[model samples]
Target: MSTMTRTPELHPAANLPTRVSLADTLSQTMTMAWRAMLKMRRNFEQFFDVTLQPLLFTAMFAVIFGGAVSGDVSSYLPILIPGLIAQTVMTACVATGVQLREDMDKGVFDRFRVLPISRIAPLAGPMVADTLRYAIAATLTFATGIAMGYRPGGGVVGLTGAIVLAVFTGWSLAWVFTWFGTVGKSAQIVQGYSLMVMFPLTFLSNAFVPASTLPDWLQTFVKLNPVSHVVSAVRSLANEGTITAEVGWSVLALAIVVAIFAPLSVRSFKRKI
Candidate 1:
């Protein structure tokens, strides 16, 4: 009689315990994000580009507007400071999409797609890194503003709130850039398209000046521009030391924008991957 070799039965229960915990997943995502940050650090030029351009833009605006528009550097410093901060943070959002497109073009994402990681984690991880970029930009802009003699009447707490608001706005806007990155054909195209879209949203609003100063037809649009509310909110916090309905409404509007765009961006990212 031939002995029958019985193969050990595979147990489903044995496999169940092998699945990764959410904590482990999050740890892995953080590792990936850290790696991405390391890569950025090694590439010093790219890092400088992201960090320096915003600083130069802020300084240029301060000089141009200080001399030409306001004619009094000290007087305009207060108003221009908030506007520069708003513009810088808003512009920083475009880098998310442009970088995403660059990574995709370089097949960095293709490697990520093959890994056994959470789908949303890759997209989410880069966004986490981008927050650092936002922080850097906001800090530099604020420091430069102070150097130009712009004093925040709201004191330390109020100034802190303004920085937090700017960072939050940048984070919310990243979702919009993520969608563009996933869908756009090339990094250059993404940059061009994103600038075209963002320029009006930023400039047409009350970022630089009061909406009342705009023409009647443009004033209506500027008043409705979400950037106007954000600028107004920042101005209120930094200049007045008070939180008004404008701040509340601006926060709500940013929340709505994130609610609408973030999921769409994730879905698009999923499809692309």
Candidate 2:
């Protein structure tokens, strides 16, 4: 008789290295972005949210609150349109975290974890696709305003710049939500936190009303709010056709937000696995 010994089996995954090259990182980002775009195309309801919500809100605000707030729809168009754009675009970013959370819950990221792609690809890729939603929301907002007899003094080029600014702000803000999405236990909780933060920043600022109308203490805060600076910058660009310090400050603040939250988000995602 002869004695026999058996060796333990090695898992397939154990053989795959996690690191990827710089060339692979860029390719992975593009590939992941395309996947996100394809998924959005297949999901028609998302397209509806991106398009219809802004149009309806613009009309509703012009109809219901226009007269109360600014004495008439026509009179209110200038301030109201920019305010609506800012509100819609910023709130649009909240969806990023919600969708990110939903994807995480569904184990989409677990699949990514096994891939030899950069960790950033799974995060930044969907964000690249989400920019389309931001564009749709912003473009529809201006179109709605135009259809309702509103005109931007900034002309086509200036309005274009305003849209660019709105998209930039939306993208930068999405990074913060990305952090929340990676660490959040659920989509609802992430959205809840986003709302708790955004509602005050959007409403308490000069978005819907004149800062002068707010009480002294509240007005002080509104004037200081970075959201207010962004709004003022957009208004200056679209309503007045001027470049101002507000744009500079908005860019600076947005850069600071990304600088702080982006690394934290990447680190969290790395450790969670």
Candidate 3:
């Protein structure tokens, strides 16, 4: 009898090229994001940490500044509300990083690694969900402001633009936080590091007060801070009823942040995984 040798059939996935298209990768990424949103829907209480604290801050600041600075609730409402909205949304970005760290510590990311998904999906997904959190905080802040007699000078369209800008900024900033989540030792460490960086960025800017009121050295830094541009952008839309160069620059800066950090975060995530 003649010996017969047969070649093994190649599986389609095995025969296919290893590389994936950018569109395919992004689609996978967005699917992961949708799953994260669904998780948020199921675990609504997790959001209270973000929503309640912002509401309290809005209330407290409105009360304190209304008497001390603006001399009336209505007067301070316009100024304090936008500031609170920006701060709350910005702070909410930290949750993206911390939660990622938590998930990693819990081995959720490791499970994802074994699946046939884009490496960038996990990071992108959580970031997208966090954007929703930012939106919730922004809406609540604006509603609270309205209740306190604040009005958006730019009307519905302007106000909508301002909210969209704030949400985009928050989403863009999540990339930096993703890097932290990938590299930080623990969720607590990530939280601490993010807070240390964010507090100064938010507080030192024109979020709470005019840059001119600061000392010269501080004023320089405040003007240079990206958050200053964002705060000015939102305030102009919500309070001033005008779209200026500052608003344009703020949006540009946010896009730059997303471009720069999103890639870095992906690289870091892949390395870690």
Residue 154 error, candidate 3, Å: 1.3
Candidate 3: stretches off by over 4 Å:
9-13
Q: Write the per-residue lDDT of candidate 2 for residues 1-273, one digit (tens) a residue.
A: 998888989998888776888888788888888998999989977777668888888888889978988899988888888888878877878888888889888877886666667888887888888888888888898898989988889898889888888888888888988888888899999898888877988988998888998899999999999899999999999887888999999999999998998888888887766
lDDT score for residue 4 of model 3: 96
Q: How do the predictions measure up, each by TM-score?
A: 0.87, 0.90, 0.93
* Pairs in steric clash, model 1: none
lDDT-based ranking: 2, 3, 1
lDDT of 1 at 257: 83
Clashes of 1: 0
lDDT of 2: 0.85
- What C-alpha lDDT values do all the predictions have? 0.79, 0.85, 0.83
Evaluation by lDDT, superior candidate among 2 and 3: 2
The number of clashing residue pairs in each candidate reads 0, 0, 0
Candidate 3 local distance difference test against the native:
0.83
Q: Which runs of model 2 end up more than 4 angstroms from their true locations?
A: 1-23
- Residue-by-residue lDDT tens digits, candidate 1, 232-256: 8888998888998988998898899
RMSD (CA, Å), candidate 3 to true, equals 1.7
